[model samples]
Target: MSDKRQQLIETALELFYQEGVQSIGINEVLKVSGVAKKTLYHHFTSKEALVLATLETRNQRFSQWLTVQIAPAKNNQELVEHLFQSLKGWFEDRVEVLGEFRGCFFINTAAEFRDSESEISRYCRQHKSDIKQVIRQQMATYADQPDETLLERICLLKEGVITQAYVAQDMSGPEQAIELLKGR
Candidate 1:
């Protein structure tokens, strides 16, 4: 991507992640990115297009970060533990550029764009499906076959932790997840 386009995407992603997609205007992105309207429009035909690009960018970055966090796991249990630890770090604001825990970006976007058929909502769903797929793949490492029940439980726990951490400002969600995993 060109420097101007990258700048616009980065700025828009930051603003959109910090503020809801509906609330952050294209002008705010352009101003913060130091790019003109013409330039932004040249790269993104519409604000909706820009929103799609921003979400796509975030999805890639978040997935890559999660992959790295779980890369050192020697087994499935360690992989799940590392995943929650990474989330705890995020909730505590330890991840750079992520800023603060405002819940999952895709979840927030999906909530803001309630129309299930919308492109933005589809992207949000795709991001979530991709995360669940990752969890399933990791779970398969320990079992001879994929265990759907365990996968669902872990994914649910992960989602619950994220929601609790974001809504209640409670950083213990991950620890609670760890305890839940212990009983399995």
Candidate 2:
């Protein structure tokens, strides 16, 4: 991506995370990014387009980070643990600084944009489905377990961890998820 485009996306994410999508305007992102309005519009036809791109950008960053975190794993089981280990670190960081952990970005965006066809909402759905697909693929490698069951359990655990981390400001929920996953 061009530096200007990336700057816009980064700026928008910061504003969206802080002031929320509904509150922040395109002008704010343009000003914070230090890019011209025409340039921003030239790159992203509309604010909605920019919103979708921002969501996809965040998803890509998270996926790439997760890939790096799991690179040392020797097998599927280790891979699963590595996944939770990352979440554990995330929660620890959140709790160490402040008790207010931002919940899942995709979930938050979906809630803000209830229309399924909205660019932000569509990107959120795609991002979430992509995450589940990764878990399903990893679970499928475990020949002994049913893929659907494992996916459902992992999804539940993920939601629980995020909820607990947001509300209780602790990593215990994700740690428990790792333990349960290990026993499977």
Q: In order, how many clashes per candidate? A: 0, 0
Predicted structure with the largest TM-score when compared to the true one = 1
Residue 180, model 1, lDDT? 79
lDDT of 2 by residue, 1-184 (tens): 8999889988888788666788899988977888999989888998888888878887977666665666665565676688787777766653322223476777777889868797677788888778777665654455455457656787788878887887677668867887788856
**Model 2 residue 40 lDDT?**
94
How many residue pairs clash in model 2? 0
- Cα displacement (Å) at residue 6, model 2: 1.3
Model 2, C-alpha of 88: deviation from truth (Å): 1.3
Off by over 4 Å in 1: 141-143
Per-residue lDDT for 13-75 in model 1, tens only? 889988888999988898899999999989999999999999889888888788778777666
Which segments of candidate 2 are over 4 A away from where they belong?
A: 74-77, 94-101, 139-146
> By TM-score, how accurate is candidate 1?
0.93
